[model samples]
Target: MRILILGTGGMANQHAKHFAAIEGVTLAGGVDVDPARVEAFNQTHGIERGFGSLDAALAWGEFDAIANVTPDSIHHPTTMAALNAGKHVFCEKPLATDYAKAMEMTETAERLGLINMVNLTYRNVAQLQKAREIVQSGQVGTVKHFEASYLQSWLVSKAWGDWRTESQWLWRLSKKHGSNGVLGDIGVHILDFAAYGAGSDFSKVFCRLETFSKAENNKIGEYDLDANDSFAMTAQLENGALGVIHATRWATGHFNELRLRIYGEKGSVEIQHRHDWSKLLTCLGDDIETGTWTEVAVDPVPTNYMRFVEAVRSGQNLEPSFRHATNIQKVLDLATVTDRDRSEHKV
Candidate 1:
């Protein structure tokens, strides 16, 4: 499949490498507003063409699929344009900044009969998938509680008074941009894990959100401060299971640690991806009478982009349909809107 990537961001770089590694999928090329990024991407990946605008690339190098890697603000337009162009699409996670636009894209893809894949990359992680399998195999019995958290220190300590904190990267931290904050970013991951593993959707949410520090990005003249730096939520799932999902970027020592533990009547399983380590640990309950805690080896995960490629060509269902990701988005939405106090706004 010929693919065109549509952004100059870091995530755009990741998708570039991911697809370049695949054999059957052809990297048709890319388009980005930033000249340096566009040039660098084409050079690094040996892409055939690089356009300065989405329009030129969409017109010049007709693509079979598009990787929408731009910021949260443009997901809707970028995706809609590509779908209108009759191209399959792969958008970075959180789908859109919010559910409405995300759903629009989903429905547009569905109406146009296109294959749309969202990059909730963890769903493709072997350890996470292995944990899900362990739970579903009935070895875990009835799932009762779940603990999932994603942590990082990038935002808090990265020269706090920057445009990112100020309104410079305002679109990201803004509630309009689907609350592109940690909830939209990492919360989506755990929500996906919960729904995908337990086969349940979120019912209601109550949240405690805070922005600990905000230094003015003197140069950007934007209100640079904390916005949902920390989010804690208690949720009810469709299956009557209770869940807690916490996401924060203010942790002092941790850097990109994703930990998930699912408890059940018969057993429990864990997926721990901390730094360079990726592990899946299981503890069996009394049902077996001789159950014991054991660590299971998770298989290596293939890039879901490759699978989406196969699905487009063969008319097979993508391992994760957009519908699945939307369910995850509902949880994200719940966290953002549930405890809304009109006067209380973070950042």
Candidate 2:
């Protein structure tokens, strides 16, 4: 598969390396508005063409699929362009800034008979997949409670503002670009991860938000911003499961501490990401306090890109369609319905 990558962002670089390492993929050059980045990418990879625009690259490269790794704000337009050009797309998630654009992109893909893979990378983790099986197989009776969190320490600093003041085109800090901030940034993953663990369709969410700290979003810093610094939510799962998701950028000493736990009538499943592979601990309750959480050893799954290649090759759908990406964003949209002014202390 010849995979053309969009954007020259950090995530795009990571995608290039992962695809290049795979046996069947070719890292066909990259494109960005920055001429310096275009030349640098081509020079670094020993590739010939670095087009000035996405359209030019689409015209020049014979790409089977595109790795749409651009910022959330432009994910819709970029991925739509690729799909319109008759290429399958594997996009990184929060597929768009909001739900509507995401839906549009997904609709277009379906209309054109193109396979779309939203890169919810955690779904590709082997142990997490196995954990889902354990729950469904009646090793765990019926899921009852779920708790998940993704905590980061970057915002706990004295200079998180000073450090980021100049870095505002960042997709995370501006509400004008999308929904509430931290929720849009990390909480999207937190909630979706829980929904995925429950193996239940996301039903509804009621969110509570707090901004423990405030920062300007523009490099100009002229505008008072309304983005989330910390957020907590409780949601009802489609399968009669109860869930809570807590995510914040301001938690101290925790770079990215994520814990996903689901408790069921017969057992429980807990999975944590220790860098890459999900470390899974399962407890299948037997008698009174009989089951103990035991670490389950399992090799991690291969890259999500491989699944994209297989889908493109075999002419199959990557189930839990990319349209599901829009559904997740809708949850984010619903969470921010009360946060219109950003002056409110809580939503």
Candidate 3:
């Protein structure tokens, strides 16, 4: 499988490294608006070709797939172009800025019979995978409730870097810069995490979003830091489970953490993914009598990157497909509406 990385940003570096390491995959090239950045990325990854724009790359038409590491807003257009060009796509999360665009991309990919998947990232978490397996296997019986939170202290700490001065971080905080804020940013991941772990899909959502002032007047140079910093949502699962899903960058003390607890009539599952490590704990059978939670040993799972390559080669679509991501985006789009009207929305 030959792949073209659609952006030269920070995430693109990871994509390049992983694809380069895949035995049967070729890096093909990278695309970026900045020629220098694309050139440097090509050199860093030992790639042979680089294109300054998607149009130029499509004209050249050497790669079989695209790893769309572009910004949130750029996903729909670039992905559509790739699919139209008969190239498979592995896109970053949220699929698109809104549900309409996401659904279009999903429909296009399916109609073309092309491989399409989103990098939900947390799907690689062994604990999350294990929790889903447990829930689906009836060990958890009928899920009744779940609570999921994705926490990050990037705004409160320099662990990732200074967001005040960095374009990468600042772009995420500005709506004009094609950012959907915290809810648009990591909200998709947590929503996917909770829903997938619980083995259910969101059927309804009531969301409240908050954009805290990070600067004087909340303006940083050409960027408007108006994107949401935090969000809390009450949601119902298709399986009749009630869940609280939330995410925030203002969560102090935690660098990056995604925690989920799923409760059912017969048993319960808990998953914690902090940084890159994950742990799973379960309460089942006799252990539930004493409120005892025992750690469950979980095996590793293939990452979205690996699965994308395999899907491309095998001509099979995988989970976290574009359609599934579109469903998640529907919930996210409804979230903004719920926040605006201060009311719940049926998904």
Best by lDDT: 3
Off by over 4 Å in 2: 157-162, 165-171, 176-180, 215-225, 338-347
Worst 10 residues of 2 by lDDT: 338-347
lDDT per model vs. reference: 0.74, 0.76, 0.94
| Candidate 3 local distance difference test against the native | 0.94
Q: Which stretches of candidate 3 lie over 4 Å from their true place?
A: none
lDDT of 2 by residue, 1-347 (tens): 88887887667767877788888778787888889987887677665667778999887857788888777777888888898899888888778877788889989999999999887866766777878888878888889889999887775564334435545333366665553578877777777678877788666667778764454333235433556778877777788888788888777877666789999888899989745345889887653187677888886666677777888889998755687777888888777763453422211
- Compared with the true structure, the alpha-carbon lDDT of candidate 2 equals 0.76
If ranked by lDDT, best first, what sequence of candidates would result?
A: 3, 2, 1
- List per-candidate RMSD values in Å: 4.0, 3.7, 0.8
Residue pairs in clash, model 2: none
Candidate 3 clashes between residue pairs 3 or more apart in a chain or in different chains: none
Residues 93-156 of candidate 1 have per-residue lDDT tens digits of 7787666777888898899899988888887778888887877788888888888888887665
Which model is ahead, 2 or 3, in terms of lDDT? Answer: 3
Error of 1 at 335 (Å): 1.7
> For each candidate, what TM-score against the reference?
0.89, 0.89, 0.99
